[model samples]
Each structure stands twice: as structure tokens, then as C-alpha cells.
Target: MEIFFCKSWFRAKKCPTEMWCEEQAKAAHEDGKPYTVLVGSIEQPYCFLEVTRRAVGVSFLDQLLRESLSYDFQEVEPGILFLTMATYREFEGDTGKVESGTSYIFGRDGAVTLRREFFNPQRLETSASSADVAANYSPKPEFGRYEDLIRVERSS
Candidate 1:
């Protein structure tokens, strides 16, 4: 299965990224498999939260149903139309917050799995001491590993 990532702000009207997602959704439906779409927009702060919140329990299935109806994809049974948003925020000094990155696993059973991460440099600083900062900060193992599973495309 091919995963698509749209690093553009989402629009209400059909955009190239959305069109690609729709096509992938349709193909997954035809193949009787799940579908996932990752979207990144710096302007939308709540996009990641909303997607994750809706993905817990039965709500995710309900969300997929609603999206299928809205996007006119007919029916997507036992499928997950996963969407995510990534953004970054910088502070006054050298501090910053990065809410970004997503991972996917293609299971042997033909299921799609997702994982997301949020990194905040401010949280790593316990005090003004460099030792404390060094002790608290460690590179995330999952960082930079998501590229193995996704294909990124920019919209015009």
C-alpha cells in the first residue's frame, strides 16, 4: 500500500492533496483494506489533536463513515481514513516546540497502524544549568524513521 503525505494547508474545496487522498481511499475500498492520509499545516493547531481524539474507539469508525459520505467514496468497510497535522512553534529565545512526524506499519493482515510524536525543547530544560538540560534531553528513537513508510507531495 502507498501512503501519501500532504504538507499543505487543507482547504474546504477539493485540492490536489485531497484529491489524492480520495483516490487512495477509493483504491483501498476496492482492495478491501484500510486507508490513511497524513496532512501537515502550520496554520492549524488543533488538527493533530482532533484526528487523534476521533481515532479512539468507535468514534474513528464513525468518523470514517462521515468522511466517506462527505467525500462521495461510496462505502469504506473496515477501513481507517487516518489524517494528521504537523506544526512548529518557536519561542522568544532558543526554545521551540515541534508537533510533527507520523509513522505507519503495514501489518501482515493488511492493516494500517499509525504513530505520532510531539517534541518540546522547553520541557527538556529542568533549570538554567547545562548539566540538567543535557541529562533531560535524549533523541527520540522514532525520530526520522517515518520517512521509510510515507511519500510526501506538495500542492500547488
Candidate 2:
């Protein structure tokens, strides 16, 4: 039952602080990212997020299929593969949208390359905001407590 505020421009699992908006505000400001505070929680929040760098191994997918909230696996063409993940929790304000996130697998120089990367603060207009540290795989909201984070297999 931690406090997440609107002033917080960012949220991540395992965030560095419980009162992120308050404690980190100074650092975020020094880094040149200014944001207004808003009120939120796991059940009702602004948006959902996924980090591309936190890739789940291919072997894990088989088991994940059993618990995935909503998902789609397809071979668009040849060696290229596409995967879409959804929320396992049923909620009205959930951030995981159907097919909103994507990744690719392809052949590269005789080796297979899996290009799955979701977090990229550099690409964001507010790179300073990217400073938030997330302990969870992502900042997306869910019904359970952090310890009850969805099964690692199904989530990745």
C-alpha cells in the first residue's frame, strides 16, 4: 500500500523510493525534467509500460501460454516472429493493450537475433524522466501487490 502520485512523471516496479514523486522530485528537477503531480495507484493509473531490454527467453513462451492474460504469436514471414502480450489481471484501467507492444526475431550473420527492447528514455521527449529506477519488469499497474507480481514466465 505505497503512495504513487501524479507529480511522478514515472513509475516502475522496484522503484527506488516508496514516495517516488516526493523523494525523487529534486533529482528529476536537477536532471531537467519537470512534471506535475497527479494521484494514482495500481488499480487506477495513467498508463502502462513495458521495457524491451527485459526480454523473456523463447523457451519460456511455451509455459507462458498457459497463464498469459492475452497474447498472440505469429510468423509474419520467414524467420521473423512477432509476439504480443496482454494483462492476466482483469481490470477496467489496465495499461496492457491488445497488440500494443511488439518485438521481432530474425536471422543475422548466421546467428538468430532477437530484437526486443521496450525501455528507451533517450527516445523520449523527456529523457530526464527516464531516470526512474524500476525493480519490477515494468511500471504497468495490476491488482496484486508487488510481491504478487504476475508470474515471471507469463509476464515476460
Candidate 3:
């Protein structure tokens, strides 16, 4: 069976030109903010889930939440969340193919997490917003904001 790994992420804003991190790009241009600075392996098709399962005791989500604490969450619009899950695809003809495989966003409340499996790509689904997850998970303020990446790194 071809088991696919799911990569979940939240970007504060979509770049207008680059099509990703547009807000951050603008921030970099206007406020002189540094690169969002993703430290993970930029190599395409990197399996974070696999890495965590092999190297760490925590799950991928846990690692992500921990890392998110330092991202720039304040740049996003209030009440807006950009959640996405994508796979890595490589074709025989393509030399460099780390392009986003598939993704969906939860822009409203009451989104559904299909199959009840967080790692299942086919099971990854969303509603209009986070109301359902909030109701089901009984998320606290901290938990809700866990998705927010607003941490600003102070330069020495």
C-alpha cells in the first residue's frame, strides 16, 4: 500500500505574488521583518510525521504546536485561521516536485475532521470554521490561540 504522509500547517497570510506568506512578504517589505525562517528540511517530500515517530516521543501535531509558539501569528486577520494538510508528490518526469499536493482551509466554525484520524489525508476535512472542534475539544483560550503564530524575534 502506498501510505502517504500528511503535513499540516498554518500560514498567517498568503503572499500576493509568491502565493504563500503574502502578508509576511509585505511585512518584510514594509516593516523590515526578517524571513519567517522555516528551519525544517526544505527538501521536498520531507516526512515530518515519519521523522517524529522515529526520533521523538511526540506526535507531529505536538511538534508543530511547540514550533508554532514562535511564529508570527499577529499578522493574520482576527478570527481567521489558515489550516492546511498537503502530501508530497513526485512524478517520473518532474525533477523538483515538492509542490503542495492537496490542501483545504477552515475559514468558519464547525469544520469536520474526517475519519477521526488526524494523520489520514483522506480523513482530513474541514467545516466553515472551528466551532465544532471547539465544541468537541472544549478548547481553552490558549488552545485556540495555539494556532496563532505571533511571536516576534528580537534581534540582539
Candidate 4:
């Protein structure tokens, strides 16, 4: 699975528009800002899950239907598997929210992570203002945000 972050991140890192920073994206959620985190499926039925991008402030809800090939998972249940490291989003996609969180990476063996998505009601209002507006991009039907994923990999 590939995850999509706000494209404006380039400006935040003082890098060229064509560049990306893994550290920057990993720490992006630590600020507690309200940001859109879109996970794209790399399969036949193409779709985008903005489950973690709700308008609420903190509803603490489950927000993912996951299938990962990055690591070997021992299924504790038919539909549930457990692993040690995974990515979590508790802040905005931008630098607006001050909520603090950290996303861990597995490095070599691959990461098995679960993101706990929370919803904010005030953010759903028509006039609600936030600094974490999602940047626009075209999602690929085959790999979702494949380019971003590659960038993260090469940055290592």
C-alpha cells in the first residue's frame, strides 16, 4: 500500500518542488495539525481512503483496511494480523495542528504499522479554517502514490 501526503510538503522542507524528505513526512504528523492522509490501494478496484482526513478534532476511530507485502505477518485471526512497527497519523497533514506524534520506520525488514485515525467535528463545518489543506495530485490506478513512495525509499 502507498500513502499520499500533501504535495505542498516541498515548500515546507525548503527543497525543490521535485524533491521529497522522508524525515519531513514522518514528522509531519507530530505537530497535531489537521491534515489529509490518503491511502491508495494498488489493485484492480482502485480507490482512495481519506479515512484519516475527517473534519473533527479527535474522535479516535479505526480507519484502515490493510494488506501489506512489505513484511511477513503471522495472522492471529482471519482478517487481523499483528506486527511491531507501523506508521501512525495523529497530527494535521501540515504544520497547523500542534498535536504531537511520531511515525516509525522499519528500514530493512519492512514496517508493519497501523494508523489510528481520529475525526474532528469542528473541521467539518463549511467555514472551518485550517492550514493543512491537501495538495492536489493524480493517483495512479496501479500504484496509488507510487512516485512519493519511491522518493521516500531513495531518500534513505
Q: TM-score, each model?
A: 0.18, 0.19, 0.25, 0.20
| Stretches > 4 Å off in candidate 2 | 1-18, 33-39, 48-97, 100-156
Q: Which stretches of candidate 4 lie over 4 Å from their true place?
A: 7-21, 41-156
Name the lDDT value of residue 41 in candidate 1: 33
lDDT per residue (tens digit) for residues 1-156 in model 2: 343432322333312122344546445434434322222343343221221122211111111112124222333344332343322322223333222222322222222222322333212111111211112223322222222222334322
Model 1 Cα displacement at 52 (Å)?
Answer: 14
Q: In candidate 1, what are the lDDT values of residues 37-103, reduced to their tens digit?
A: 4334322221211111123101111121111101101112232232222112222333222343333
In terms of TM-score, which candidate is strongest? 3
lDDT of each: 0.26, 0.28, 0.24, 0.28
Error of 4 at 109 (Å): 42
Q: How far is candidate 4 from the true structure (C-alpha RMSD, Å)?
A: 17.6
Which stretches in model 1 have alpha-carbon errors above 4 Å? 1-21, 29-34, 37-45, 48-156
Q: For model 3, where is the 10-residue window of minimal lDDT?
A: 50-59
Candidate 3 overall Cα lDDT vs. reference? 0.24
Superposed by TM-score, candidate 1 places the C-alpha of residue 45 at a distance from the truth, in angstroms, of: 7.0
lDDT per residue (tens digit) for residues 80-139 in model 4: 322222233354454334243332322223422333333553332112122211211112
Off by over 4 Å in 3: 1-34, 40-94, 98-100, 111-156
